[model samples]
Structure formats: C-alpha cells, structure tokens
Target: MDEETFNISMRKFLKKVGVTSQQEIEKAIRAGLANGRLKGDEKLPAKMVLTIGGVDLTFAV
Candidate 1:
C-alpha cells in the first residue's frame, strides 16, 4: 500500500477503536457509580483482551 493510503487507513481504524472503547468505558463507569460499586476518586483495575487472526494480546489498563 502507498504511504498515503496506509496512513489514512491507520488513522481511521485508530479513531474508531479509540472512540468506541472510550464510550464503553464511560458507560461502565457511570453504571458503577450508580450502583455504589465505585467512588469518584478511586483507581480502578482494568484489563483488555485483543485478538487478531490467531494472535491474542492482553493489556492492563
């Protein structure tokens, strides 16, 4: 792929993933707050799993 095409596709993919992940996190946080599962000033443990083709990756957030 050309540099221009690769950059455009990468940016679009990253933006979509970033935005959707952020929205889901915010929704979860809101639910936690409503149910008294979380306080406004606490560090929450987070994890994420990603699978691509035959590879699996785990991340700590």
Candidate 2:
C-alpha cells in the first residue's frame, strides 16, 4: 500500500474501534458504579483480547 492509502486506512480503522470500545467501556463503568461494584477511585485491572483469523493479541487497560 502507498503511504497515503495506508495512513488513511489505519486512521479509519483506529477511529472506528477506538470510539466503539470507549463507548462500551464507559457504559460498563457506569453500570458498575450504579450497582456499587466500583468505588470511582479504584485502580482496577482490565484486559482485552482481540483475535483476527489465526492471530490473537492481549492488552492491559
């Protein structure tokens, strides 16, 4: 892929995933806070798993 095309594609992909993931995380956090499961100032450990075909990746949040 050419530089311009690659940049555009990556930016599009990142924007979509980043926005969706952030919204979902915020919703979950709100639910936890409402149910007394989170104290609002806790450093909680979080994990995310992403798989694409035969490749898998793990991330900490």
Candidate 3:
C-alpha cells in the first residue's frame, strides 16, 4: 500500500480499537509481533484489506 493510505487506514483501525495515538498502535503492533500474532516481514492490515476513506486504489488506473 502507499504510505498515505496505510497511515490513514491504520489511524482508523486504531481509533476503532480504542487507540488514539501512534504510540498505542506501535505498541500493539509490536506486541502482536512478539506473540506471533503478527509477522516481522508481513505487511500491514490495510495493504491486504483494501480501501481508505472509501477509496480503493487496487483498481486504480
């Protein structure tokens, strides 16, 4: 995913999960990684999920 879309989707998910800051998201992601819930080389959720603020660039031309 592009940097802008990744960040925007991350912020939205964080807010939905009750995280309000970058620190919180970072901490959560790190924890997930350590626990094997996330992977060291895997991409972020948005990259797989698709769409940001209703925009889906997967089909963009």
lDDT value, candidate 1, whole model: 0.84
**Alpha-carbon RMSD to native, per candidate:** 2.7, 2.8, 10.3
Off by over 4 Å in 2: 49-61
Estimate every model's Cα lDDT from 0 to 1. 0.84, 0.83, 0.69
Better of 2 and 3 by TM-score: 2
**Model 1 lDDT tens row, 1-61:** 6999999998998799889999999999999999999888999777766545556654444
Question: Which digits, one per residue and each the tens of the lDDT, describe model 2 over residues 11-32?
Answer: 9987998899889999999999
Position 31, candidate 2: lDDT: 98
Question: Local error of candidate 3 at 11, Å?
Answer: 17
Using TM-score, give the best candidate's number: 1
Better of 1 and 2 by TM-score: 1
Instruction: Order the candidate numbers by lDDT, best to worst.
Output: 1, 2, 3
Model 2 pairs in collision: none
Worst 10-residue lDDT window for candidate 3 reads: 45-54
Candidate 3 lDDT over 1-61, as tens digits, reads 6999999998988677554455677888899999999878777754223344656455321
Error of 1 at 50 (Å): 4.3
